[model samples]
Target: YLDVDLSLDQVHLYLCEYLRMKDLEGPYNAELVPVVTKAHRSDAVPSLTQHELDAILFEVTEANENPEYPAVAVLFQYDAAVAHNALGVTGKAQWGVLAGYDRERQLARIIDANAKAFGRSWSVTCEWLLQAITGYGYIVMRHVGRLLRRQSVRGSASM
Candidate 1:
């Protein structure tokens, strides 16, 4: 059994907020979808394979299920579908006080991981992936950009 310090309601709210910030919503919240058009990124570079997608999903599920934040599992599953449906990157908008990592750090880690995996900056990788998948990457980039903007504002405000 996973033990979380926060109530389930709190986790749910955070999940919704994250989705709102990302502009990803709808039935199943599935951002990933079949694409009939050939994307420039995929044509120029290699396409993202189902195997890669499965691996990423596995990692996210494991992270979400970590006992530190019990509600994270549900939140993750919910957001992932939303992001997938929107063709959004599955790792953005990783907010909340769950699973031991704060929202910002979680976003950063995922961005960094994508950058390392794709040999591009976080934003570039997100764009490439979205283009590869059809259009979901744009949604992820928007949320990540929002987070970056917020951080910048907060930093300037602190001065």
Candidate 2:
């Protein structure tokens, strides 16, 4: 539903805002990190290193275990060619990248896993749906209102 293409910084800010709205009591909050590789450079074909994977897996485990933070979601952006080598291989200490419908399915699995690990239900939602429709007009405004109401109800019940 989100139409706007946000830069990484903007996404971080929005994530912070959403976390704030959660009103979770903690010493630390959720953090979003963008990992970029220089594979596009002709000089070097950078791939996700084992150390990097270990660090990311550690972060994911920490995020799940830390009482101060709810969760950490790593968004990886990579070229198809680089991903093919970096992800599809077996016996590698790296997590494979899921794309298209598989990405959505894997995301759901992650949410479910987090829910079990944290003893709570987890869900993902995009903020731009409200941002995009609010200024459009009456029909859009009504739709946004409904969406807001639904979200508020769900949030209230969940938290």
Highest TM-score model number: 2
Clashing residue pairs found in predicted model 2: none
Query: What TM-score does model 2 achieve against the real structure?
Result: 0.34
Tens digits of per-residue lDDT for model 1, 1-159: 112343344544554576677665431132222232354344544333433333333334444454553222212212232322344545433221112222233221222212232333222132333333332221111222122222333323231
For model 1, the superposed segments whose C-alpha errors exceed 4 Å read 1-37, 41-43, 67-132, 138-159
Backbone clash count, each prediction separately: 15, 0
Structural similarity to truth (TM-score) of each candidate: 0.24, 0.34
Give the per-residue lDDT of model 2 (tens digit) for 1-159: 111234445555654675567653243343333333343344543233333333333344434454353344443222222222234432211121111112233221112212222223322111221121121111101111112222233323221
Worst 10 residues of 2 by lDDT: 136-145
- Each model's C-alpha lDDT? 0.31, 0.29
